[model samples]
Target: MTILLFGVTKDIIGSSTLSMPSSSEFGSKRSKTVKELKEYLGKMYPELKKLSSLAVAVNNSYANDDTIIDNFDEIALIPPVSGG
Candidate 1:
């Protein structure tokens, strides 16, 4: 799976995009839902857990934690924005 990162997320992850193996093998660590994705990322990059808020979008639409995900889905991480 591929995830697009924006704003602070991009900074934290040190890249604009991230890739994960698209496999559903018994021992594969692929995320199956939005919530799992968050947990997976948080574990890999603990700094992500420090953010005040984080949002996820699937195929350009905001998705909830229960939202199902697959390797073919387009995912994005949106970080909080502060403005004057």
Candidate 2:
């Protein structure tokens, strides 16, 4: 699965996109949930946990922790944003 990064997320990740193992490729332990994905990312990118907030989008829609991610689904990481 490829996750699109935005704002600080992009800078922290050092890439606009990140590739993760698909469910079918690594089996059940690999995780198929958005929450799990977050935890996985936090582990890989420790800086992510320091962000003010983080949101996950699946197929262009904001996704919750329980959201299941398919192997071919479109994923994106939305970082905190503030403007005056």
Candidate 3:
């Protein structure tokens, strides 16, 4: 699966896009939830954990931690933003 990173997330992750094995390719033994994916990303890129707030989106809609993700699904990572 590929994750599109935005804002500071892209800087933290060092790229605007990240690719990882999907649950299907990795098998059911791996986690498929957004929460687990967060954990996985945290481990893979510790800088991601330093963010004050992070948002997960699936299919263009905001998704919660418990949302299940599939290999073919569209996912994006949103970082906090500030504007006047």
Compare the candidates by TM-score and give the number of the best one.
1
Q: Please give the lDDT score at residue 45 for candidate 1.
A: 91
Q: State each model's CA lDDT, in order.
A: 0.88, 0.85, 0.85
Encode model 2's per-residue lDDT on 10-74: one tens digit a residue.
99989999887544333365447888888878888899999988999999999999998877889
Model 2 lowest lDDT segment of ten: 22-31
For model 3, state the Cα shift of residue 27 in Å.
Answer: 6.2
Clashing pairs in 3: none
> RMSD in Å for candidate 2, one decimal?
2.6
- The model with the greater TM-score, 1 or 3, is 1
Off by over 4 Å in 2: 23-31
Tell me, what's the RMSD of every candidate?
A: 2.7, 2.6, 2.5
TM-scores of all candidate predictions against the true structure: 0.89, 0.87, 0.87
| lDDT for residue 8 in candidate 3, whole number 0-100 | 89
Candidate 1 lDDT, 7-78, residue by residue in tens: 999999899999887552311554478888898899889999999999999999999999988888899999
Name every residue pair that clashes in candidate 1.
Answer: none
Flag regions of model 3 displaced more than 4 Å: 23-31
Error of 2 at 52 (Å): 1.6
